[model samples]
Target: MSIRPADSTSNPPPGSTSEATSEATSEATSEATSEATSEATSEATSEVSSEVSSEVSSEVSSEVSSEVSSEVSSEVSSEVSSNPTPNLDIREWIRIGTLEEIDKNGPMVVKGIVVFQHEGSLYAVENRCPHMGFPLHLGSVCDGVLTCHWHHARFDVCSGGTLDPWADDVPAHAIAVQNGIVYANPRPKQPKNLDWHLHRLREGLEQNLSLIIAKSVVALVNAGVAPARIAEVGIDFGTSERSAGWGPGLTILAANLNVIAKLDTYGQILALVQGLVHVARDSAGRPKRHMLQPLPATEFGTPRLQEWYRRSVEVRDIDGAERVLLTVLGGDASDADVADMMIVAVTDHFYLDGGHTLDFHNKAFEALAAIRPELRPQVLSSLIPGLGNPTRSEELQNWQTPVDLVSPLFAAFRELENQLGRISPATLASGTSDSPTDRNASSIDGSASSIEGSASIMPSQTSPLLTDRQTRTDAEKIVDVLLGDDPGVIVETLTALLTSGVDPVHLSGLVALAAAKRIVHFHTQNDFGDWIAVLHTFTNAHAVHERLKQSQNPLATRAIYHVAMRIYRDRFLNIPSAALPKSDAADRAGYSTDLRQLLALTDKQQQVAEAATWVAHYIDTGQPMGPLWNTLGHLLLREDAEFHSFQMLEAAIKEHEDWEKSTRSIAKDAMRTLVLAATRYLAAHAPTARELPQVARIAWRLARGEKLFAE
Candidate 1:
């Protein structure tokens, strides 16, 4: 997403959502399946610069066509019998807004998903408003409740349970994140849902057949056979039991000897074996249809000749197929390419989600790491496109979600490094390695034992820098330069760190730097939602740090608070116009608290002044300001106004003294601000001047001397 250049001297209107809905992916690409057209909403247009206003408006209008189509289908489908199963699985993975896209209390919609990120993980539910099927992505996240933007319905994201008095709960999807990328895999279809089952079956059949045919056509072409002749052969194989083996069986048997050796050593073989065993062993101890029937149907020929065959193949260990493929391809290919092909082949048979296995990924990383160190970053860049700008840190966090399944991958890379003699046993086992003296010789071959103890290698944790600050600066600089020049630097660095179990905060800091520069914009192609989210996260941590430091080391609080206030101001005042307006009273109060917290960054005296100013504004403007005004006014009266230490100590002796003093010290002063003109008018009619002063004095006595302004 691109960041718009705001006028440095002018603040936008309050409640304006100009930057909220950033222009995210110009084109959507699916993570699990082929691309699907994205549905953009009115909020998305809120961020359009005046220059591109017409273009965005036209794009939005175009989206209405799709909405109309969905509505028509929904109406028609409503008449049909209810189908509990999903019609589509593996729909495209959308670039949902960045962590910042959804405000603390705002709901963000991407495609048809209602998503919001809190802490570090993301939560998504179908966007249809549960009450009336209005889009919930336009809703709000308030005090852990997702309140629908339409009809005021509510749902608890943690349970997907409806809180609205009139609504029933709707379906929510399971969200998976890997390396800052967010994935939503719809809840699996129930077996009893026959309609859903049919849909899934049709989808699977189409996908499997397409893959099979593509491979078969490629194989036949390589064998110098004609397409018509291949069709004839395939037709014969459809019915003849012995000929059935000619398809997938022969496909696997094509691998050569060298490829077989690599397959034997690769860890993915274990993952494949495990998956195949599970898929083959259905719930009732029967084989799954795909596992047993290598081909669901074979249509042999055109008008002159026609034939069809469908049958289940006999049992055979999945490994046997792998062994055959390796034997055929090994001698003719390099280990890497051969391994890549083996992975593809294994992935197809296993029906894996990513079309890749953990071992293959590990092997890929290992291969990349073993090559020239300078080139490894480029390879990583392909895996993660927007790496350097920390805005994709959520993408990284999402990336880490997939690590559990991909952890064994590190082992593969480590083993590869070990084989190349680039990593020593000590480093592999303990994260501490002795340097080899012959640097060039050490990494040149499959094994370099000659410089075992002679090489000068630094341990992973020990950098030459002396102070944490220096190390941080160096790391930040490296990250900045890499982010600016190489797309993969951030991903590579972060992956390495995650694999090492390093603290995420360090990585978060680097990401914050990128966000600060507006490099990683995931909210939209032209938005800064991603940047804002990262900044909000970082500043929150800083705020906590300041709070902690106040107790442990008072000296650090001022600096940290200052930094936090700067972030809060930028985030709060600059919220994009696309952001939905706050509807819930409690939510607006929370926002007031956020502002108060920001104001607390100033001194005790200034804090009171600011609080008074805010309270006056709240009362006059009808803003549901926070509940801290009483305490702040108290502090202002005692500490600043010095109303307590007066010859009025005699008047303070009267029964109504507290009230009189409070009115004079607090109310009289609050009336002066231009913003409080309305408030002053209202107070004049509420109580007599004599009675108001007495009430204020009583409040001053009740309040403790500490600053009541801090919210």
Candidate 2:
């Protein structure tokens, strides 16, 4: 992923890819990019910079300073936008004969360097324009400024600084005349520091320039900057700049960061870049958020703040919620307390924002963990606006009629709390509390108050289900019941687990395992959109798992019931559940374990079952997992995967790892479920226009001096 440094200042060469391939590389766009730009293809290619000399030859080795101007990544955008090149010549000083060999107003390219004589002075620069890889020789130089006719971006002759704010500074080379011999550096002077690259990364994000972003990503990562640091910048921008607050971009960023280490070098870079690109789009044209201050010191402790925060969220009061969150964060309340506050409120409404509320909350906290803990206030406050108005699932017809899941679940919560002897903060009655503490914990948790007088809905099977496990462990038995057809039994089984003093985290993990199974068992025979249904349940379970581990707050544990109810609603998707593909001796013959074949399965169409089949084969044969992880990463990184896909892959990986470490007998089966879940989800979204990964590939190849543009 690192780029080499060059001595002379010259334009870049195309990568080794074919002209047809590189031409399409310039057109990379995903479903996400198309919505962000009028012409995604054109917009992505418009910021190419010429820095090809860095990879001039394998022999000319100096191992360019890791500090070699971080902007050297432009070579990628510039080269790939054109045709691919096969041959490259490297030299410290490329001689251009004597003065007589140069024309008075000549625009001549020697070894990718453009030597020019302007105003009776000798100068040299890249043969192509720093913006879009257009031939610099085609445009006329006047008044000591280089202008690319394509975009009208103006650059200085000496310093290569941009005359226009929109265009980045061009790479300037060192030109000299000695002993009647004219010589120029093939490589342009690159920006010398990570800060410069970071600044450019911001610029790329600000203008939504894919070329700049592509280049900056290659440079910063190649320069050895930690992925978290880069993600922190995007995370900070995405949260603060978008008035809408915590959106898909940041979520994708957090999710990708969770599994980035499992990817190949190129995949790692692409994963991060994809996240940043989404962040840029999410915040594009949006005004920066005006942050609210925390309330002044008051008599309220963490419990009261928790109540007030939930109450504010319950009323859809953004300002009040933000103030309350900031107030709690500004006090001695730990991160756990902050998480409990958000989770209780999120669960207070069934599947708030279609489960995104909990997912975003989880991501925000995960994003916070990746950065400084001091960012807690800024990070947690962003969750307010999304909570202002979310689609409460309880009001939906399906959740209400066939099975009054809300009332029964609420009733179970009341009875469960009675046994546990703790008050919950989930409100059942549509009545708003006059004050934060006005309602008892039972009301806040939807436990004390009956849901339309439908109290007492505990599982009739709790007694027998716990004892007759078919030789399954307690965790396995609970998971089996969770994925079963009985909604009432599911609730009762969960209640029994919690009351039996089973660790709440273990229960939450089982719920997540059950949710993952829904995806594993999902049949393509069902509607395509149902994928999101299963995805929502798992992501919510993921958030619940994390929060439960953080704090076993009575209110936090309520989310488990909420997540289980969602799993029940998703039961229909598993009808005629897709069978796992098994590997027999014949199946292990040829290409069954091939990573390329697994990826190829995604290239054609929604190979949902086929992908799961491939993953199951890979795992069953005891093939190396590193390559499997790498291949799974390619499935997402290569497509125009939107928010949920990113969320699913990361969560699935985490869940799989969680199961692999468990002492349960079915842990192996659970791992296969998660792997298949992730693989199938990725397969469904695979083979998009593929414009997104093309950009990353081109950038990567160009940085490595692989051919990209024509000679």
Best by TM-score: 2
Residue 454, candidate 2: alpha-carbon lDDT: 41
Residue 198 C-alpha lDDT in model 2:
84
Backbone collision count in every prediction?
62, 31
Per-residue C-alpha lDDT of model 2 across residues 53-111, encoded as one tens digit per residue: 34432222331221122234544334323232223322334554455566543666665
Segments of candidate 1 deviating more than 4 angstroms = 1-75, 80-197, 200-443, 446-475, 481-501, 504-711
RMSD of each: 33.3, 12.7
